[model samples]
Target chain A: MRVSLKTVLTLTTLFFISACGADDAADSMWRKLPLNNTVLLTLPHGKVVIELAPQFSPKNTAQFSKLTQQGFYDGTKFYRVIDGFVAQAGPKDGSKKDLSVPILAMEADFKVAKDWAYTPVQQQGLFAQQTGFKDGFAIAYQQGKSPNSGKAWLTHCPGTIAMARNNAADSASSHFYIVIGQAPRYLDRIMTIYGRVVHGMQHVQAIQRTAVIEGEYAVDHRDFTEIVSMQLMSDVAKAEQIHIEVENTESKAFAERLVKRRNRDSAFFYNKPPPVLDVCQIPIRSRIVK
Target chain B: MRVSLKTVLTLTTLFFISACGADDAADSMWRKLPLNNTVLLTLPHGKVVIELAPQFSPKNTAQFSKLTQQGFYDGTKFYRVIDGFVAQAGPKDGSKKDLSVPILAMEADFKVAKDWAYTPVQQQGLFAQQTGFKDGFAIAYQQGKSPNSGKAWLTHCPGTIAMARNNAADSASSHFYIVIGQAPRYLDRIMTIYGRVVHGMQHVQAIQRTAVIEGEYAVDHRDFTEIVSMQLMSDVAKAEQIHIEVENTESKAFAERLVKRRNRDSAFFYNKPPPVLDVCQIPIRSRIVK
Candidate 1:
């Protein structure tokens, strides 16, 4: 509860650096995710994790790991959020469980390997001509010279998760969605995102929206938000897991935190900005381990 | 409760127009806002409006209409929201106002008028080298030719709003905030934006977020988000007015909504995109005229 611009209000007076209780103690500028393609979910207030990207949507991360190991996204009910845009969940109409899983195939973009541990970040991207970071998500590519050019997907940014298809680009299965605002860029290469919450994006920005403008009040069914289960962090139980890590956005201290987030040699800035860096306002960090 | 991706899921299955119960009846693509430079705010979950850019932060929208006409942002509380980023509110420390009102004057970049009504919308902008829309906010300019060669600011997209100074570029008096996610193009030209929440950006994305993380819970004070009063929609009361409108971003139906959002010739897109648009994902329609 501080702001007289003294204890950090916002719209800048420079307050960047609260990757919560920080002190990375260099685990080599962070790493971990991909324990059999992570995931945690759980919500009624917290526990989101996620990760996935199985090398860029392998059959939608193997049908979201066979629908969260068949607990099928537990109680599923973020029934279509859409505040800054998107929260969605499962079975909203996609109807429940099993049926030999099927329906997927549009990894939207993929096929990277011409040396793809990519880490660029933005060289003019409002619709990619370059934008970056790979493993921890947010991407864009196709800078050809023979990698069969133009591939690489995932870029909806804000905690992206993707999958919930319809106009038939192979209509995704177990319904999905997450983004939560700002980086829509018209669903770039059209959604197949696969995963990325890497630790509760504030429980996915505290989902619950389902749109309601004027004097509000219309989202009921006990106002949704459910999904109280979903595991697979290699099946959680090691005294109740939850380690997470992240930040090695191809480290060198994340290219010095992307050149201190693209130039702000800080003096609380006196009109400087123009080295440019809005890879969705870069904040890679992600922590939580004790 | 549909997601079987039939009734529009997100990440595109096209849910484009639902500017809520639409049907504008051609009031010529909307207009209004500027009733003594609008504002409304209120909050136990409804009413926001805002709209003040007195031609781009004129003395912080006249010190936010003289501290929202003296009630000084009623009950103040959104004490720092920061989920996708930013919600802030006044006096979390800026104290109970009126130190003879004065504390503005940065207006972070203005001086347009090389035939101003701008409108363009994007030519590669991740930190503007062209991005547009003028009277309905989201801007960026300067394309030099001697009118002092560089100015035109307002843009931190998402429901913007600004003002909350500290490191002294004319300290900005009563704290404010609002951009609520994604467009923190590093606080564009660094803060002084003034207003825009035109129509309760879903009650400012339902504020109440002050950082939490592990199984959440740390934003107590009855979990903040209070500000329940604020007026000056020319001092309300014409049977509770709220006719807003807005969508004349140099009309011709907003240049056919920026050419159908820069070529998304719907067939619900079958791998098309790359005609770029992201002027904060272009949606400019706003409404509520009854």
Candidate 2:
């Protein structure tokens, strides 16, 4: 989600103003809470909306908060666009010298055995607190490892938001990227992932692709889809009215749907795939009822 | 690789005239070969130089031949533009009326143990028979069950030409799609594999993406990247001089590169991945050496 710092500030102010109430306080708080917070990303062609998934990736949400509070991603553009691969974005500082705020590298959430064992068998509507989100921010959790080893991270699936790194490990600060094609799992732990473009991905994907720039071989020159403005829905009075829900992962209906796609037992398949599902391949769509 | 048909026709004519040796009596026979041996596809965004891969898929090639000869794809436009999936083109005849050509659905290419294996154990490259060039078309054997079992076909890797089919068994014709991202393996045998894009895939990818049209849910509008024209590079004077070479699949260098990528032993990889390589995940980079 391409957010402008102005919107973040507006939401902060609104949050404080609404908190000043009493009699209708609880109701007002719930009503003012962000619901189907949608961000409209304007591209050279058109716009696409991304609904954030906050339940899954709280850390990612927190990082997004920090970055926006500092106005870190305000003027940045998508700099890398590799066909069939990904489109990356980040701070304009190629040398890490221009960072406006303090930056840090995030840890990895590799799906190792112990990690997998600790990963609760996914349940419908039951939030899995590692690298998952309500919108498009990167996320992770503390599940298994040593006492301090239960850590999670944002994944590099399509539409993911990650920080760009230099040769050194802690080089990532204000840069980021969005996966536009096949999942680039190769970049799993090398960079810091913060969020993703949950709503305006089509707008991000439709940017005019160009040859790689000279100095930054990994970056592209296509003008990024413009950001009219991105704000937290909690800042707006109408935020309370919008509600959206994701299909419960552990539900029977969702299980059947996944089974059909993963195995293709339908007459259509002459050969069935192995009973394995790549977490990234699963689709998480959001919609509003009434 | 977007070819300007007009330019190619001019180049083909000039080359044909020049290639006719004055000393050979057979030159007279060759001179009679019509310049109409090529087909030009004009798109709005840019040009795509498609040398129909007929020899790779004789039946499908013949189908294309019949369609092009009849100017079936003349006014048609690219319809589908999935950001990371594919960009579909061909006759937008949603009725599936293009299936009039006589080629039945063939089994998937899993029969040939050595040639069709997806596991990394088997070697892979552009070495399928019934494989040859039709004019400038790069084609392979079109495999059928009965008399056509051993036949070859054009692999649908990227920049492929294919017949669009519905859920039915043998429905495909008119509508075709060019893969703009990773190869869509699921559609392999379900539709007839025909040819590939020889050049100008960027032009195809640059086409604007839009919501599927009203009646034809599969097709987008004609707001495609403009194609200056599409003609064979072979027909141009310096086309032969433009020397290029694909990495030999049997070479030790190719195997070593694959192994390195599969394991990610490079400094770039901080962790080790499972030693598995999906066939379609490989990268094939092309360059103009000379």
Candidate 3:
């Protein structure tokens, strides 16, 4: 809307998003990810850190980890980048068979168990009965936690990293994609999600987009975004490493944060929307800690 | 997914999205827009055609047309652009007072009349009981056609053009914004949506964005995208004119099209999603006609 700089300015002043109250970001409320499982993917523009969701898709993340450790992803180019769809990267097309690594079985979704835990966004979705967060990952699942009563899978939210495959359900290899636009809920259980970008998403957004003519397979050979390297965080020198901490989704403070956002007490929202929020729309806080 | 070029190629082969079955795109199924109410907004890269929704917000569109005729939008810079939010432009900050145009009273929403017309998506939305397309524009509204039973408003879908305003309910003068990313349904009845971009959304996506710090009003001056001109189609020279025809949302052909897309009966979709589509996600067909 016109004169919205003032509005956005007001929002910025009211909520210092980056500097969330020091208490909220305190050590106890935030959880550190396992360095060995985390990836530091360096693009030409900047570095993007991806936290692998091994618990959800062990096979996919394992194969990705193996590929990264072997330097298979170094010099890989983001060959397919649709502005509002996905940014995919890996060895060139048809080259996966040449590598010694075996194609991993798809872990696109799993049956919800009795002990299945998640920070519920508690909103009904077009694709799933319930949508929410699990260990800091956006996900959708069938309602009811009764063992094997429902299925659960990571959602295709922006910055999501999922394994790419062909017609065959389990035909995925090292090639993967990052969700770059609106949440494509249709691909939820069909594609396996391995990880998510926890930092430097702006650089990922800045990735040079390839020309895509809607349904046409028009591949123009131009300067594509290249992957300089993909390394495990633990491998980097201590001084050069950038440690990260994500807000514990299950924490009381995080729940309060969600409630506060759901209830927009701001005068600007004269016509307040329903208390429910879209799972994919909520921003889960993450930060780089010294 | 990997080998997706082949997948996308298959989809292109199966369904030419642009070249829908000739019968589906026939004149009977397509509705022509009034030339005088249509606008051709030219940018540095290309042109974006916008069709004004005068029925919904007459005052707002009238003011915009008057401003366009006065050459008010030419050479304006998209001074504030958030990648996943909005691309705004006009006479710059604190410049609305310099214009002679009066602030149009807000027409953000209206109560549904007995004859309230819409091509019902028949899908529930996060913000309303129903969401759908009305005269080719995405919208959300309270359910029921009974006169004055509920409210309806244009949604903030990608490519939507809405008037920007401050705290005052009717303070919008000239500056406006275009939704560029995920549909922020939360803004439904808060801002006046007078028009929508029917064509050249890609060019708008290619606009240069300003750097923004999360929740911080740190504006770094960069090569901001500029507006060359915005003119009503009727005022354009005959040779330069590009006539547009949109698929009649109320037509049976359009309803069938929606069903086909909603069903997604493809081999790629091993597990189909619910037989429902998000109102903001549906692509209303528009074509250039001689």
User: If ranked by TM-score, best first, what sequence of candidates would result?
Assistant: 3, 2, 1
Against the true structure, what is each candidate's TM-score?
Answer: 0.32, 0.63, 0.79
In candidate 2 chain A, what residue range of length 10 has the lowest lDDT sum? Answer: A118-127
Reference-based lDDT, residue B188, model 2: 51
| Greater-lDDT candidate between 1 and 2 | 1
Shift in Å, residue A286, candidate 1: 30
Q: Provide DockQ values for all models, in the order shown.
A: 0.15, 0.08, 0.19
Provide the lowest-lDDT 10-residue window in model 3 chain B: B10-19
Q: Which pairs of residues collide in model 1?
A: none
| lDDT for each residue of candidate 1 in A159-196, tens digit (9 for 90 to 100) | 88888777878877778888877777577777788887
The candidates' interface RMSDs, in order, read 19.9, 13.5, 8.0
What is the C-alpha lDDT profile of model 1 across B123-142, one tens digit per residue?
43546666677667878875
* Best DockQ among the predictions, by candidate number: 3
DockQ of 1: 0.15
**Per-residue CA lDDT of candidate 2, range B1-290, in tens?**
11234543443343333233223432221111122333345566544545454434556556666666655666555556665457776554544644455544542342332233111221112123222222222223434556534443334565666766666656554566777654454455455666555444555666655543222234335465333333333343454332222333333344345556655666655554333343444544433343
Question: What docking grade applies to model 1?
Answer: incorrect
The true-versus-predicted C-alpha distance at residue A155 of model 3, in Å, is 1.4
Give the per-residue lDDT of model 3 (tens digit) for A247-280: 7776656766765776677877877766656777
